[model samples]
Target: MNRDPSGGACAAEQLVEAGVRPTRPRLAIMEAIRTGATRHLTPEAFHRELADGGVHLSLATVYNTLNHFSEVGLLRRVGFGDRSYYCTNAAEHHHFYDEATGRLEDIPGAQPQVVCLPEAPPGMEIDGVEVIVKLRRSRQYPR
Candidate 1:
């Protein structure tokens, strides 16, 4: 019922089909994480935006829902350390997380360079895999 007319209607539909109740708070959360300029975001940052925008959602709820979304494959978790980020992988592709700026950018599956593995490590032939290119500004400048 509560949806931005000009916002991500596709995300909304996906959420519904994914069995997630599209509540107002969930809609707001989805809209930000789904259609925002920023891709990689922590739960604190995400909830901060929701609060800053005057959308009444608690950080706890955001964390809970994000966890659920990840489990349901609606989103993907990036990074390994304490610094955590989430990205909506509605499209099947990889991602590039810029560490210097702490941002996540989607890298489409259709890339100029293709990597193929001839043999499997063990008995597993092949499964879906992704590559995250974490970027940072060059620190050195040659004279």
Candidate 2:
């Protein structure tokens, strides 16, 4: 982990390593996401977090920054229906989404092997595969 002058961990160095210029808002956003308890966060949730910390960034800025981070390989964007969540783990992996809580949790270890994929068009090729297993409480066993 990288540390700031005050000896506290910060995301500035990681941002630079990811080829992103670390600005104040960017740093704050990165730090919040990196150190936050939740592994995945939506743009609106991120905005609220920053506001709670007294950072006061606009929702547009939060959305743009998260997208920029995804483009630069610093984060990964996972879509579920009409909502999108930003994940700090950018590596290829699968996830388990809880329908009851709307939480996304990383599936440990390597990605599962996929079989018998259809060939891509003449000019295109499949790049990667992402699997999301949705979970909900069983009706037979209420929580």
TM-score of each: 0.66, 0.83
- In order, candidate lDDTs are 0.70, 0.82
RMSD of each: 5.1, 3.9
Off by over 4 Å in 1: 1-13, 34-38, 108-128, 139-143
* Model 2 score (lDDT): 0.82
Local accuracy of candidate 2 as per-residue lDDT tens digits, 1-143: 32232135458887887788999989888877766543787899889989999899999999999999988887789986998998777777889999889989888877677899999999999977778989999999997
For residues 64-96, write the lDDT of model 1, one tens digit per residue.
Answer: 888877777677766565776776554456777
What value does the lDDT take at residue 120 in candidate 1?
73
Residue pairs in steric clash, candidate 1? none
The TM-score leader among the candidates is: 2
